[model samples]
Target: MAEFDDILARAADGGRIEAEDALRLYTDAPFHALAEAANAARERVIGDDIVTYIIDRNINYTNVCTTACKFCAFYRAPKHDEGWTHDNAEVLRRCGEAVDLGATQVMLQGGHHPEFGVEYYEELFSAVKEQYPDLVIHSIGPSEIDHMSRVSGVEVDEAIKRIKAAGLDSIAGAGAEMLPERPRKAIAPLKEPGGRWLEIMEAAHVQGLESTATMMMGTGETNAERIEHLRMIRDVQDRTGGFRSFIPWTYQPENNHLKGRTQATALEYLRLLAVARLFFHNVTHLQSSWLTVGKAAGQLSMHLGVDDLGSIMLEENVISSAGARNQSKLGELIDLIRSGDRVPAQRNTVYERMSVHWTPEDDPSDDRVRSHFSTIVADLQQKA
Candidate 1:
């Protein structure tokens, strides 16, 4: 029987591990065996289907953030002219547009606005649900919960319960850049500590809310720090089984306070993706960010163990604000997945298959195009 270390040792030898083993695999194991084992693990979990993506849109409700993290380029302070908030009607318009364009989910993310208390989200979420009951309100993160609690004078658990009761379907892991305190403070000094992030996530999980986990790489953190981030999430996952997926994205280094000096490389991203697959044994879904890394990297990601290609974001602003730029058309995304020898499936927030395209031969024609566009931008000019 193969022990865990033996499996890791074999993976290291085969050039399949890096990042740290990525750091060590180049020197440690027989590269072939390491690659074989990692590949086998990927195959065993994801199988040969080559997982695809969802046609969803990210509707950033507001840019007004109170936490002035050093590494952020998206948040706008209260007095900053760029700071703005989306009202319920505007948020619903975005949801309506997403639903019109066949988007199954709307990733509603924003900063920790000091004044936009729990009532704001409760109203916004309830309105969205009232109008677009079918649209998955996969919005908010732990940071928002923390802020809402502080603003409303409620506890974290209470805030989560109210938001969930209003309409939030699931939480998205946004504020988790690096779980280590040293790196976290260096990058996002105003945000909650690493333990608090996990605690809030665990509370959300216990309250019947499922969420995803994320890591922002290349912020000058050590490779060991990256592994520690994974271990932290893995530990919580071991306890509650609440995290649905683990997404590892490279930090964009353009307009943010943290400049282009130390962005995670493509090879580094792939190594982390592969290592994430190996380390997070209990996490089921591993998503790749085509929006941050280019489509080529996203395609290569499948070979490295990413089962989901994330969303075909009709609109994305945060990373774009930071100077990361990549977009994929619906047709092109399907083609890319097939090109990698995988079936393309559109999934909702919970990974349920809403639609699946087996071959290019079954592609939708011109008549189907209008409806798709309608779902994403029917009321783009509407204000929030």
Candidate 2:
């Protein structure tokens, strides 16, 4: 107990904790003690007065994918009847709706269609920027970049540069399900290597684009492997320092190829959250994933070192297809944060506070700012 207390004290004081210390804290520390240490660490970096959320939309541009990852339920083979790609016009329409509902960021995410390469992204990104110049296009990840580069017969750096020139604001850490070889291969064997993911992100950072780091729990990965994921991210962050935040989400087991597997328990998720805060001394923000875990767990995470409530995902399909049905409205999200004894602030893609909700009166209501409206998926299903 004394040794654990000493480690916790050092971590709460903003000192770095090694991988072994993190393992002990994650596996052996009492729940309340771990939460206290993590909250203290968070307070030492980000103040405890406010929690943040984002108003963003996830636009799945296509469902055709060649990489048939074992854990994915969102993609269809290219020649499948259910596979569909949104025309540029429909994509623009979704962005318009998102903007009208006060979205500051649009995430253009989808599977890797062999026919769609870097040029496809360049044209789409440029069109979005030309129309909605203010919308932050924080979309895609290292895996997508790698796929696009390969399909276009270009180098990875060239692909990143072309997309950035076409108005990509930053990258999202989506494909980083796990960074260790054992678990990553077991879940996503066809996906790029974990080290390659980090290297592409490093190249993006060098080219002046920032990104977030993510890990998807409950993919049958061991606790040590979870810690290893964080270690991999932290090492890369040590050199590039381009990761603005670290987000960890749980895997949705229903309707996916990894079906019949149990999701990670809420307690495990909370423990990982605390450990992540203590481990990533270099990462600035930690986001709570209310979209994957239940709302109750997300609310409790506020006290366990989570400072961001991710987004009130205006529309989501990929995760929804895998059975994540939790939803939140604009006002409801603010109340969720405020109920945790923290003010709610709306932030842009870059973590800039756009508006701060200091009190109930400051909370705005917009029914159109829905948490779930999968028009694309619905339309596709109807057509099918």
Residues 1-384, model 2: lDDT tens digits: 776999998888888889988998999998899999999989999865689998889998999999898778899989999898988899999999899999999999999999989999999999999999999999999999999999999999999999999999999998999999999999898899999999999999999999999999998898898999999999999999999999999998877788947578899999999999989999999998998998999999998899999998888988877878798888888888898888999998888888998879988888878688555545656888
User: Against the hidden reference, what TM-scores do the models get?
Assistant: 0.89, 0.98
Relative to the true structure, candidate 2 has a C-alpha RMSD (angstroms) of: 1.3
Top lDDT model: 2
Each model's lDDT comes to: 0.77, 0.91
True-structure lDDT of candidate 2:
0.91
TM-score of model number 1 = 0.89
In candidate 1, residue 326 scores what lDDT? 75
